[model samples]
Target chain A: MTAPVDDPATDERLLSAFLSGDTQAFEVLVLRYRSPLYNLLLRSVRDPQTASDLLQEVFLRVIKRADKFHGSAKFSTWIFTIARNLTIDHARRMQHRRHRSLDVPLGAKEGDAPSANGTLVDRVVGTDVVGERAVDSQEIQRRVAAAVELLPTEQREVFLMRQLQGLAFQDIADVVGVPVNTVKSRMRYALERLQAALADFEDHLEGTR
Target chain B: MSTCEQHQDNLLEFILDELPSAERRALSDHLSECEVCPAVAQRLRRGLALAATLPIEEPPASDTKAIMRAARERSGDASTSVTASTSMLPFAMTGRWGRVRAFLVRPQVVMATVMLLAVAFGAWYVPRRAELGQPPAATMTQPLVVASSGVSAPEEAPAGPDGGEDSAAGGAAQPAPAPPDTAARLERGLQAYGRSDYVAAIDELNAVVSAPDADEVAWTSAMHHLARSYQQNGDCASATRRYEQLFRRSPSYNRSNQAMLEAGTCYRTLGNEARARELLEVAAQDPATREAAQTELQLLGEPPRARRPARQPASRSGAPTAPTPSQRPRHSDAPY
Candidate 1:
């Protein structure tokens, strides 16, 4: 019986087809994951081109190592794990380069780099916007995006994986290599940070409601 | 814990709609009566809504196509039965002339033609060589020396500028033959790299790379290994520096393409996408490295280069063949 190429029931089915020599099945998988994975990577790297490249690399790894994938975990979890590892490597390299150039000691957090202005959170979120004229929804959105950018990498990743990608806390924990409780706590702290940063906007939104 | 503190734990889950039905109902009931709970829930809901506004971007269409093409190519290489079936279908369905054309273009046919031509040329040339009383072509050239292990054999060392003799014989200030100790260090470094002892490899390889008495070949090999050791040890900053140095100092090195591809990857890992693209683009031009470099370039958001239409049989075209058993370079082998 021919496997219908149009719609595969599960990602694992597509991957199995690919292993058995169906290239079209692999294409279906790529199309399915393209947007969510791209957005996840974009949020992680904060650059469109880097995110795009990473998206391709994730699939490339899948293509090369599809056979190594066991059915013990989901195909999504396996692919996401690859993406997370690549991102971690990218962050490490960037951190190493930055530390060398700035003469910052290795293992120093990015937030700890001495700056005249303040920490990223302080600079981005400490502004007094509550007394200003009411902001449109677009403005609120822009501020929210900026605040997300300012989050510590760990919290930002958890927030995006949960809020944007809609990954379960358990799946996120798997991808992050943390206990589920740690993942939940990170998500909580992330929300708390976002709430503080957007307190003024929240007020504006409440008044409008 | 205070009642409010206990409720705060479930507030986030409730807002996220992740709380089970029963727990969600309880939290919803508490929110209606608690003074602080409703405001906290509203704030979180607003935060989640705003964060969701960040756009979900679609990647360029070319990226999807490139990924699929790579998968097909890899699959073709991996499964001979797939290749046979797919390749034969086109031939069978084509018209008579198309079938003839396909047969002519087949790699086996092309290789056979090349072999017949070579034999015809050899028959014409061999008697002339005997008439001239010349030494056989194989004997006229230097014997090919293959290194045993990662250590470069003495015979395989490149000829120095003053010819392959020791620079001391020419009274030049050029780098001399590696001292016994330096040679030993080089051997140890390579052995360490082979065994994945990157920390010890770095220590040993660094000494050989820095030794004044190490010859050009030894120094170059040592530098390559040192860069690899740094990479394996996750010190990419040092690795990038060394790889770049290799490019500048030894541009004509046989493994320069491989070095360029790796350096580009290191730059990418270091978050320098522009420089990574620059190096990968150059490496993509070399046949030996084209596939790997193109893959990296694709990952860096560079469009895949247009593939050549017909596959040229590498052996017939004199392209570099796969490494021989004696010349097996592990993925981490030194460039030398």
Candidate 2:
């Protein structure tokens, strides 16, 4: 991903300069980090509108608490930590609301609200309607989403942050508040289960050949 | 740990393309040596490749910019209000003055003032008569002879030997001063300045600054050091003024660039933003002047102004120069 292009040193320097009374240095810092931070949050939270809202909240917190970024870790790590914590808090709130509402179970909800999951990908891909093509691409994506959802929560988080979000394993450990080995183990178990679940399709392809 | 478990775990991250380079190499080596690990590694890699290809969609590009702009605007507002809150600080300090004035305006301060006046009057007026043994409303005190009645006493004296005599009559003794050798004094002043005795240097330099026939070198150098002395003494205001004088009078002095930077910093420290920016911008555009200017302007949130190459003053030659203003370098902006 071209390493996301926001130089950690430069970001920290801008932050330090801002704290030292150069307010405008912060503008460049904000402009530079916004996109990567937005992408990270969107992928984690999985809701575009909510992710957009939380992205603003993250930057607002960044500016207000700029002095607290003491360069103890790489600036990227610190920023992602902020994003991670905010994402978790947001998810917890969402979970509480969802539980209180006591809505339908997963597969039924998926069937009824095809537009919710399927349309998001279709709209993003800008193709014909998601329902028009239930072929390999859509089926594969649906299976991948289901497989990821099926993982234990901690394993899912570790997998998302590590593989999809491109955070280092150490950072995943920090984000999830576990030992690095524990994160690795969860990822191992998660990957094994996914591989097993997709074995039928692999075997069916072998048979067709 | 069991070999099967370890191999399986390594296969997971290796398949996902998430293993670090060193670990990936190690896993590759392990797969080549361990027969059973290959099947596991292959299956995991294939499965992960399939998962990766499942095409997780990104948010639309239009949304990216829109969201970021909204984020920036929100944060900007938050920071602006924080800045506004800081601006209220001076007013809070001034609030104490109002409270102090209110207390003073109460009847208590006036009553104390009256009481003080009464005690002072009794001590002075009532004691004077007894101390002098003068009584009753005594006859005519002849008009006190005021010196040189028609002329004004010239408020003290003009600050010289004659002034000292007038001062002596008012109850202090006077000392004679030696004649000053302007040339010798200036020479010694430069020497003292070179040795860093700025106190003696300023004393010597002051004589040269005021001398009627002072050479430009001596006058400029003296002013520069006088400014430096004031700066070293923590009198930044005086130092800044002297530096301004040095630059204005001798703009091509060896230290003029340094002086300009220092003067800009002093103006900034004193909260004169416009003047500080003006000087810093000029300094920042010159190749010779950029470093110091860089530090100052980085803290000011302002960019340096474009600088024209040095031109001979038209006043000196009475002819317009060939290089037009538009030919000058454009302002180079540094990142905030």
Candidate 3:
């Protein structure tokens, strides 16, 4: 959680505890990172099962080699670097982009802005979770998912890592093995692209009220 | 650093709430005065807020439970069966090839690749000259490598003076290369050590160990290989002394545990059982170097492994203080 960011003892501390033979700290560490790690693999492999399996492999690999982690690096960077290498390995083997059938908007057009009276965005933002609203939420998700899918792989990684994972720019540089400047540039590009894609949705939200 | 154009990008970062407070303050001030930036910032914030409304994709409860259970088991045992709990890494390029690709873009690796080529040539050509009954090119001209600047150790060192050195040789030099720099000399020493030239290695490493010009990094590599050189050259006296100096000066050196281990081995070689046991006990504290120290301890007719907390010493009279069975010096376990 982002709450841990303000805690004096962060991921590195948990890692240190795990390394020093505290098995419980290892549990906390895994729980804390499981979702982000899983989501990263999901986005990369575009398969929940493969992503879940890969997440297991990532933590296992990190644990087996945890004794070798140099404390100088943020544990987040080290773990993400491992995650990235594993994802890259999958990418190399497949030799193609992961398919995202979710990118195609349903019950709506890709470029069409949401309507005030009734639209996918209206149903999602509205306080309803019934039969129709659930479908609406799913559609909104597909649209948002496509927005990320449209991004270049590097830009998407920067976005997922920054916005979702809340990683610092410096740590993202370590994960991607790029200069911090490059990471910042990539994030800027991702934010701009996401902003453009989602602008209509924001306008719809404001217009409805 | 924010120009009007750059501030536009800064506006996006600010809206994401990712900018540092000082930059955030500067941007806030900029937005208040600038005609276009405030509007741009507001739009960006709203757009970002819309994106944030994307629902979180929570992992399956079963998968989370399975993962947490595996983590619990795996953390307890280093050799636990990975198959039951872990999946194989998805990528095939998980080894040296991947690291090589990563290194390709780094300036340090480019310099190192060039140096490795030179070292490879030297390793091939220098010996061929000797075999061909001609003076070695190394003897005629300097084959010095430059000292790389960085803390390269990938694992924790004991709480002591930092004396860590990575096995990879690096540092940029002129096309011809200077032989006098500490890094170059240290590299030359390691090359000699590699070729079984213990005498040459000892001399070169000694120069780095004693020189005022030598930095801590140079001192580490030289001191480590120097002791090995002495031990290999059948001089345990000097090897033990050098190892002792390294132990004292750099308690936190990457090879500090190895220092204790080697010094113990050297003392064992010199028939000094008391000194050997003393150092071996210290080496045994670090899990990294524990097995080797225990092996040597057993070789000296002591218990197989007398594990102890680093702060707690072994029983004063309980330890079997017999001399080593043989006079042979142990080989250093340092990766470099």
- TM-scores for the candidates: 0.47, 0.41, 0.46
Tens-place lDDT digits, model 3, residues B38-124: 665665566456556555576767665665555666666656635324323333233686576556747798899899999999899
lDDT of each: 0.61, 0.52, 0.59
Q: Is candidate 1 or candidate 3 better by TM-score?
A: 1
lDDT of 2 by residue, A24-77 (tens): 666666555556566556655555666666665665556556656777665655
Off by over 4 Å in 1: A1-8, A99-138, A203-209, B79-336
Q: How accurate locally is residue A196 in candidate 3, as Cα lDDT from 0 to 100?
A: 52
CA lDDT of A184 in candidate 1? Answer: 73
Global Cα lDDT for candidate 1: 0.61
Worst 10 residues of 1 chain B by lDDT: B308-317
Note the residue pairs that clash in candidate 1.
none
Comparing 1 with 2 on DockQ, the higher-scoring candidate is 1
Q: What is the alpha-carbon lDDT of model 3 when measured against the actual structure?
A: 0.59
The per-residue C-alpha lDDT of model 3 at residue A53 equals 73
